[model samples]
Target: MMIEDVKLSIRHRAQRNYERQFDERNRVQTDGIVTLGRLTIESPNKNMGSEYVPSPGRLIEHAFAHLPPDLREYTFIDVGSGKGRILLHAALHDFKQIIGVEFAAELHAISKQNIAAFSAANKHHPPISGVLGDAIDFIIPDGKCVFFFYNPFGRPVMERVLENIAASYRQEPRKIYFMFLSLKHERGNDADANRELLERQAYLRPLKSWNANRGAWIKLQFGSHKLTMYETADAGNPIKRRQRGANGAAASHLE
Candidate 1:
């Protein structure tokens, strides 16, 4: 196997082992809350299942490590955002807007309640909103957007979302940052294909990879997961095409 493939294999194995350990715990901490900057919100709980665990806090920190230092001007959007943990954290930054899209009705309610409560406490800040809708169907706002995911769904849904984003890029190109966490080895091929497709459109660029050591103690502390950031290239200018005339010449402008 190639060197990159070998590294991915090791990473996948470590992640699986860590997930298994979390499963064995059998404890659900859904109602637990964490403070992000001045906002209080519900945090990730293992009971939500392995798929719902929020991206590791360390992973989020590392992903933003190389940011331009003017994060406040950006907007962060988290799909399948559970309990608003990621959204709340993003709000603490300089992000102009923070939005979370959650399909589960119960989870969506929880997120709204948490955001409302946080807003009441921090009256000086603008309130963040959580929409109850399928991530696949949610409408992404037009602008420089930071999209976040923590293995929210399976490959098929992911593919559809990528296609949707590609379409959006075509319409109104914007810098898009995709942050994927706890990605597995088996999904590497599909992931790379999606990345290639985005690159082919001249829409994205791989920015950084945050790999965490997965020793026994480390796994016990944060579960099994790593994070990576993919940045966006400048949006291409819209191209305008003209139709050919009857004789293959440029079409005359109609009055």
Candidate 2:
């Protein structure tokens, strides 16, 4: 086997081993991958979705730590939540609500079962539920929210989802946070495309300490994935306000 393929195989094996223990500790069965062909649900946008790969707990904790200090004010929504691994983790927080949106019928059912198992063992968590539907058709909920994405779908679906978010913000201006994590070196990865798409949004502001020399965040690595965070600029933040104003017609559309 090629050296790169060998390395990848090693990583995948290690990850599965770790997740088996992770599932045991959390009393849930959330390990393994289900390719697009294996997904049993029939959805118009199913092809846009990538395979179901559960997020690692360590990387999740690293990413969540950088979110707004008071998670109580924001609802955690995991788009393409796979088997609800992230939802269970979010339930440990004090968020107003915890939700996972997965379109695949098989994965969605598994996620619901996992959530039930998690809740039974840990009864003090916030409201947690799974919504099975195409993310493109899912309406952005009212109030502040922290949207988490792990390269759930292709660029087209992601673009529509972002547009919906912007439109929702226009109808009712509110704070929103976005966390996107994806493989760092994988070719044709949607995470990279989605991150660039998000960067192009005039109204969204990236949250990270910049390294001007490198022209990127000082650190964005979480295991094998790269994580990028953003938040809707506060109306009063003069810098971002000015940025939004400078976008001309595009900025006007957001209003």
Clashes of 2: 0
- Residue 165 lDDT in model 2? 87
* lDDT (C-alpha, whole model) for all candidates: 0.60, 0.78
Question: Which candidate tops TM-score?
Answer: 2
User: Which portions of model 2 miss their true places by more than 4 Å?
Assistant: 1-18, 209-223, 235-254
- Can you write out model 2's per-residue Cα lDDT over 69-159, one digit (the tens) per residue? 7888788999999899989888888899998888999899999999988988887999998998888888788888999998898899999
Worst 10 residues of 2 by lDDT: 210-219
Q: What lDDT is obtained when candidate 2 is compared to the true structure?
A: 0.78
lDDT by residue for model 1 (45-155), tens: 222222445554444654665566776656788887877767765655677788898766667777787676666555555347898766677786887778887766555
Reference-based TM-score, model 2: 0.82
**Residue 159 displacement (Å), model 1:** 1.1
The TM-score measured for candidate 1 stands at 0.63
